[model samples]
Target chain A: MLKVENLHAGYGGAEVLNGVNLEVKAGTVVALIGANGAGKTTTMRAISGMVRPSKGRVLVEDLPVEGLAASRIARLGLAHSPEGRKVFGPLSVEDNLLLGAYRHLPHFLGFRSKAAADLKKVYDLFPRLEERREQLSGTLSGGEQQMLAIGRALMAQPKVVLLDEPSMGLAPVIVQEVFSIIRRLKEAGITLLLVEQFAKSALEVADYAYVMERGKIAVAGTPEELRKDERVLAAYLG
Target chain B: MDTSVIIQIVVSGAFMGLVYALVAYGFQLTFATSKTINFGQGELVMLSAFFSLTLTRLGAPYWLMVPGGLLFGALLGLFVERAAVRLALEQKSEGWILLTIILGLLGFSSAENIWGRDDHPFPTPISSDPIHVVGVDITPLEISVAVGVLGIMGLIELFKRRTLLGKAFEAVSADRDAAELMGISSTRTVMLSYALSGAVAALAGILVAPITTVGPTMASALILKAFSVAVVAGLESGFGVVVVGLFLGGLENLASLYLGSGWREAPGLLLLILALALRPNGIFGKASIRKV
Candidate 1:
């Protein structure tokens, strides 16, 4: 459902993602695992149009999305949950989620009940946010904010969602909880592309795996194939 | 001093405060959107008032002239945003204070050339009839000032809460990147903020013209006090600004009457200092995140 072909993207004078190619089928998780500054976040940003690719194509359902604004890319059903859980700090939890659903705003504005039902669905996915519906999002815990971030992107009703370091700054237990939620999302048929530094945890859930090093994709394989690969074990598993 | 004197001073203060709140609201709008202000806001007011006076002389009715003059203010705001504010953001200019002040001076000088540096007569739409309050007389203009500010505040609240563009604006104000991620055009929202601010400032100038008289540089001191109001109330809280507006107006008037007219503005400013000392975030403002 999504494809990135020979993509090249960078900031300032330095190129961070060079000649990268990847694809994700519907209803599966594709994990890109790498070290810090491995161009994982840069790749996610390029795909979402937060940073445009200098060369190459990004396609969702075979429709080219290069050169679009981040918000416009979001409208094409590709949502991004940023690396730092960048929730709109002063806004209420509910508004933050509604921000995720920007493409759906016109649909909701005409029918209050529809918006309410959507909110109820998000509440079911993460009950804590419902309890803190009126509380400012910045006051949320690391785990809660991560959940809120994912919930916000889900609010967009996107066909593909990008997850960037959902585990960073989160406790091990919270990380497990967030990953479990990702598991639930996969079971519910939401396509996901995740970038993470935690190899073991990411490998367990990732259907396909790609290891990146210095802005280049060094290896790509099925999860089982990568699990047995010697380099994958010696370099990343340790 | 009789109770009558107190009431009359309050009536005057309230009237001036209406214009004060209007001017302060413009400052608040610009800051809330771009985390910047047009210190030239004063020029917008002075120029708008001068334009109204010019129109009145040419036979335009007060109401007809008011909107026309305000459109000029709005245009002025748009121009500043396009040429100055946008340039600052593009170049990542750190000296917003200096740039805004320079713009203010430019605007002031432009109006100075037109108005010839003199005060001119500008009347109000409201009748000049005076109403008695406990044996003290107050004019309808004063009443209109209070009522007008309140009315605009209500309208603004409704617009922000109910409209799609308003909601988009709120989103942008809270988080620029996230708003962009949501498909909101940050450029449009920022320009809208300036437009709203300038329009309100024009309203303030036209409203106060009958009492203060129109002049090229009249809004300089007024804008300073309005900036003080924005500081004391905090730009994030629109409601807090109105409360601060009313309080400062009353305090300024009371101080002038009881202490001395030269020290009239001192009380409001002193109160601002006190509020900032107690709550640096602002009396009703929220504490935003500070990057280390």
Candidate 2:
């Protein structure tokens, strides 16, 4: 459903993502697991058009979307829940989700009623969010904010979602809750490209996984194949 | 000293202050979206008023001229954004500060050349004769200023709260990147803000033109007080500008009455300095608290 080919991108003079290639097929969860500064987030950004790629092709459903503005890329059916849950801090939770569907919904009036079904689905997935629907997103706890972030991305009803760091700063228990939600989303057949610091949690749910080392994909395989690799076992799992 | 006389002075001063609040509100509108404001906004007011006056002279009725002026103002605002702000913002530079000022200077010259340098009276159907209300005399013209200022403010505030596009506007203001992720174009939102701000500035020009007269230099004195109001009230709060505007206006008239007419501009400047020294964030503005 989404593909990045020979992508190169960086800030200023230094290059961060060099010749990185990755793919996520329809209705599958692909994990990009890497250490700090491995270009995982940068790769997600490049795919979503937040950071323009210096050279390469990014295809969302086989449509090239490399050099467009972030908002333009989003309109092409790609939702990116970026690093550090960048929720509209002052907006209400429901408003955040409503905005997620901005590309499809009416711009002015009757948007709420139009997005009712999608909103209901999201509310069912995270009932806590429904409870705090009117509260500002900034006031929510870290776990709730993460849930809001994912729920917000789902509101877009995008063809593919790029989730970066779903468990970056959270307690182990909250992280577990997050993974369980991911499991639910996977079972619901949502296509996802996930970037994570926690390799073990990511590997358990991923259909295919890539271990990134210094901005390049060092290894790619199924979860079982990855578990048997000595380097993957030593550097990440061990 | 008759108590009603004092009431009359304060009421008239407060009416003038509302014009400052409206222009200051224009500043807040653009600041909320792009963190940049048109330094040429004062010229926007002058030009729109001049244009509206021309509309009146061209056989358009007062009702027709108002909307015509507002439309012209919004277009001029878009022009300022395209001509000055958008480029500087794209490069992430403070070049807009100089660019907008230059645009204002250009606007000033254009107005002088087109309409001449002399001040012209802006005709209104409303009576200048004072109406007795609760033992105090007030002019319908003055009352029109208050109504026009508060009315537009209320409508814009309503739009921000009740519409999806308005919510998108707030979203961009809150987090431009996150808003972009939602498919809300920040560039378009910024453009919309400039347009709305332009409309507002034009309204200020129309409402106050009758009292102050339409001229290239009228905005200079008005813009200074508006700046003081925006600073003292903070750039974030809409209601803050009105309250501060009314207080400053009342103070100015009272000062001029007691301390001599030269003191008319003194209170606004003093309050601006005081607000800057004691409360830089403004009395109503909350200290921005964001968790990393």
Candidate 3:
């Protein structure tokens, strides 16, 4: 459902993503794993229009969306939960979620009611969020914030979701909980492109996976095939 | 001097202070969304009042003239955003400060050409005769200023709190990138803020014009005091501006009464310098913590 072709992007004259190519087909979880500074995050950002690509194309449902404004890309049904869980700090959790559905919901009155069902779905996925719906999102724990980020992305009901570093800065227990939520999302048939530091867990949940090196994809295979690659096992699994 | 006389001066001054609060609120609006404010806001005030005066002279009723003036102000605001702010913000530069100031100067010259250099009395159906209430005399014109200022402020505040679009505005203010991911356009939000700021400035002009008279320079002193209020109260809090505006107004009146009439502008300047030196973030503003 989402495709990237020869994407080249960077900040200021320093190219971080050089001719990186990838795809996330409908109803499958694709994990992009690599060590620090391997351009995984930049690739996600370029795909979502956060960082404009220097060259190449990004397609959401086969429509070229390269160089569009991030909000325009979002309205076209691509939701990106960026690194750092950049939730609106002063807003309540419910407001953050409602805004995630901004393109679909009414701009003025009755938006709360229109978003009621999506809110319920997210709250069901993370009951902790429901309990703290009225609380300011900034005060939430890291794990809760991660859940809110993921929940917020889901609120958009987008065609594809790019989730970057969902496990960053969390306890192992919380990371496990996050993965379980990912598993649930996958089971529910959501198309996702996940970037992660934890290769083992990512491989376990991914239907297909790509290992990135420098600024390009180094290996691509099914998760089962990836698990048996000696080089992949040595560098990442170890 | 009688205590009642002192009460009258403070009360009257407080009403005028509310006008400053209204203009300061305009600065807060644009600052919230884009972190940029129009340096030409005083000119916007003066121009809108002149426009309303022309409308009155053209035989438009007060009711029709008010909305007409506000709409004109909103369009001028959009012009400022497009001409002065949008490019600078996109390029991530502070060039807007100079650009808006230049635009204000152009507006000042234009007003001179169109309305002439002399102050003109603003005609109003509302009588200026003071009404006696609890041993104090207050004019309907002054009461209308308070009501208009507070009414518009209340309505804007309500829009921000109760509407989804308003929440989206707050979202952009809090985090621009995250808001974009949510499909909220920060550029449009900034535009909306500028438009609202312009409308508010126009309302301030309309409300105070009857008392201060309509002239190219009418808003010069008022804008300075409003700037002081915005700085002292902090640009983020709506309620803070009103409180600080009222306090500064009363203090200035008392200064003029006791320390000579020439001292009218002293308190606002002193308060501004004190706020800058002691509380740069403002009394109501939270100290921002940079998380690396």
lDDT per residue, candidate 3, B122-145, as tens digits? 999999899999998999998999
For model 2, the stretches where C-alpha displacement exceeds 4 angstroms are B290-292
Task: Supply the TM-score for candidate 2.
Answer: 0.99
Report the CA-based lDDT of candidate 2 relative to the real structure.
Answer: 0.94
Which stretches of model 1 miss by more than 4 angstroms?
Answer: A52-56, A61-64, A107-114, B53-70, B95-99, B134-136, B258-260, B268-280
User: TM-scores for all candidates?
Assistant: 0.90, 0.99, 0.99
Model 1: pairs clashing at backbone N, Cα or C within 3 Å: none
- lDDT tens digits, residue span A1-238, model 3: 9999999999999999889989999999999999899999999999988899999999999999999999999999999999999988899999989999999999989999999999999999999999999999999999989999999999999999999999999999999999999999999999999999999999999999999999999999999999899999999988
Task: Tell me the tens digit of each residue's lDDT in model 2 across B195-269.
Answer: 999999999999999999999998998999999999999999999999999998988999999999999999999
Best by lDDT: 3
Candidate 1: tens digits of C-alpha lDDT, residues B56-104: 8899997788789878778878987887787787567856667767877
Off by over 4 Å in 3: none
Instruction: Put down candidate 1 lDDT per residue, A58-125, tens digits, no spaces.
Output: 99989999888887888888888988878888778987877677777762245334467777888999
Q: Give the CAPRI rating of model 2.
A: high
Rank candidates by lDDT, best first. Answer: 3, 2, 1
Ten consecutive residues with minimal summed lDDT in candidate 1 chain B? B90-99
